[model samples]
Each structure stands twice: as C-alpha cells, then as structure tokens.
Target: MYQLYYSPRNASAAVHWLLHDLNVPYELIRVDRKQQQQKSAEYLKLNPSGRIPTLLIDDQPLSETAAILITLCERHPEQAKMPALVSPDRSKFWQWMMYLTNTLQNELMVYFYPHTTDSNGIEAIKQAQVVRLAEILTLIDRELSHHTYLVGDTLTACDFFLFLLGYWCLALPQPLTEYPNLTRFMRLMAKHPSITAVNDIEQFDLDCDIFTFID
Candidate 1:
C-alpha cells in the first residue's frame, strides 16, 4: 500500500484524487501545516523539503506533484485515464503539468504572500505578479477553449494540476470571471465522481485551507 503524507488542500489533494480514480488502496497521513508538522524532524527525515503530498511507495518516498503523478501513471498503466510515459502524447502531458506547477503555482504563491519574499516592496511586487498571473490565466483560458482536457479527451494528471490551480483562483481575492473557459473547466472537474469521493474522505475538504491566500 502507498503511504501518502500531505496536508489537505495542498498538491496532496491531486494525488488523493488520482488514487481514488485508480481505485488504489493507500494510507493518508495528514501533515498539519498549521501546526508546523511539515517542519518536524521526523517529517524532515522523510522529506527534507518538508513539503506536503510526499508519497511513500514500497518504502520509496517521492515528492513534487508532477513526479508523483507520473509515478502513479507508471505503476498502474492499465488504469490510465491520462497519458502514459511511452505515449506520443506524453510530451504534451509533461508540458502542461510542468507549466501548471512551475508557472501557475509559483505565481499564485507570490500573489498570496508578496511580503514573504519582498519585505520592503510587497505591494508593487504583488501588483506585478498578479498582472503576470492574469496573463497566464488568459492564455490557459484560450487553450481550454478547444479541448475538454489539458492533453486529450480523457482526464489526465495535467488536468488535475490545472484544476487545482483554477480552484485556488476561486478562493483568491480576485474573481475568475474573466477566464470563461477556465471557469467552465473548473465546473466540469468538480462534477467528477472521483473528485467528489476524495472530498468525501474525512480529511479532505472542498474548501481547502492551505490554498487560501495568506496575505
């Protein structure tokens, strides 16, 4: 069985959703970020970065959402609803996942807590970051216009990553009304039974506290 260490509302949720979709049995180990459980020495031994959503598969620990999702796809190729490692579409899948993780996720973090990095000039940085994030969202909105999922017809890890990013926007101080396609995609993702079932788990909440803007 896979052992997942994560905080609700973190990238861990994406892994949780994927596990549910694959019908894989796993143990959910909650790392209470509010209580600084992620920084505890015991957790650090598992993941020095102290990040949530670390998956322990057969005693091997894996971090990063993209990496974990790819690992899952590799382990359970038969249950793939997403692109497989050897598929021609794998490149596209990797592109979208990295974009969501590196670009969208990073910008959202900066937008939430500008002061965390720029102690003296937070407002200016926040404004600039927000504009850049809005531009990125606009591009994503256009991309979703012609495709139901990020890569192809069936839902993939790419779509789950994008969905998590879009969900963050919903709780942001800024509204997502400007991105119509993104809004539509978010609505569709919410209706998936796998996603709903993950939410039903006692530890998972639809309104995740970790993603809420921290400013």
Candidate 2:
C-alpha cells in the first residue's frame, strides 16, 4: 500500500483525492501543521523540503503534489487517472498540470504566505495578489465555460488538482460562486463518489458547500 503524509486542507489534498478516485489502498498520515509536526526530524528526513503530502511508493519518497500525481498516473495507466504517456492528450495534460501548479498554485502560496514573499505591508501585498488571482480565476472560468473538463471530456488528475485549488479559494472576496462556470464545475465535482469519500475522511462540513451558492 502507498503512504501519504498530509495535513488537513494542505497541498496534499490533491493526492488524497487521486488515491480515493483510483480506489488505491493507501495510508494517510496527518503531520499536524499547528503542532509543527511537518518540520519534525523524522518527517524532514522523508521530505527534505518538509512539505505535506509526501507519497511513499515502496518506501521511497515523492514530494511535490504535481510530481506525485503525474508519477502515479504514469505508473498506473491501467488506473486511467491520466492519459497515455506518449499520446497528444498527455501533452495537453502536462500543459494544464504545469500551468495549474506553477501559475495558479503559486499565486495561492503567495496569497497564503505573503510574509515570506513581501517583507513589508503584508496586507497590501496580499490584496494585490488577490486581485491578480481574481484575474486568473476569471480566465479559468471563461475556459471552463466551453470545456466540460479542463483537458478533455473525461476527468483527469488535472481536474482533481484544480478542484482542490478551488477548495482553497473559498476565502476569495468575490466568492467562487460569482463565476458561474466555476461554480457549476465545483458543484458537479462535489458530487463525485471519490470526492465525497475524501470529504468524509477530512471532516469538511459538506452540509455547507465549499464554494457556496446552491444550484
């Protein structure tokens, strides 16, 4: 069985969704963020970066959410979590995956940890980042309006990655519901059995939707 070191609502969330979606037998180990367990000596040995959602594949550590997702998909093409490696679809998948992580997810990191990026006027810097992220959201909302899925008609790991990022966007000033296409996408994804399985384990209050705005 695979093992994932995660903290609630951290970047590890995407990996958690992937494991559930594929029905892969795995262990979820919560490295408490509040307690600073992620930086503990043992965990640091596994992930030199001391980040959450490190996957142990046969006792080997794989850090970075994007890398782990792509590796899992490549290793288990039989699971159909991603496209065939040499196929054009795989090329498109890489495009979305890299864009999601490097572009979108990076924005979120700055938004979440502005202190690390800006030495002064953290709130001002954060608000600026939020404004920038809003533009990114609007762009994705527009693209999502035309495509049922991010890459293709069928769901892929890219969608799962974006879904978790959307989950993090619950704090946005405009609210994700304002973007009709994004709201629709999140609502539909929320109903998936795999997503619900992770929700149950994570203790998220499903009674209230993550992005708000009903139907």
lDDT of 2 by residue, 1-215 (tens): 99999887778878898888887799988888999888999999999898888999999999999999999887778988787767677888888899899989999988988775546788887899989999989988987888888877789999989988887887777678778888788877877787778785666544566435455
Cα-lDDT of candidate 1: 0.80
| Local distance difference test scores for all models | 0.80, 0.84
> Compared with the true structure, what per-residue lDDT tens digits does model 1 show for residues 1-215?
99999777788888888888889999999888889999999999989998887999998899988889988988898987567667887888888888988999989988876765556788888789878988899989988888888786778877777877788776565687668778777777776777887775524345543323232
Model 1, residue 158: C-alpha shift (Å): 1.1
User: Using alpha carbons, what is the TM-score of model 2?
Assistant: 0.92
For candidate 2, the C-alpha RMSD (Å) to the true structure equals 1.9
Per-candidate TM-score against the hidden true structure: 0.89, 0.92
Model 1 stretches astray by more than 4 angstroms: 85-87, 115-120, 202-215
Worst 10 residues of 2 by lDDT: 204-213
lDDT for 119 (candidate 1): 65
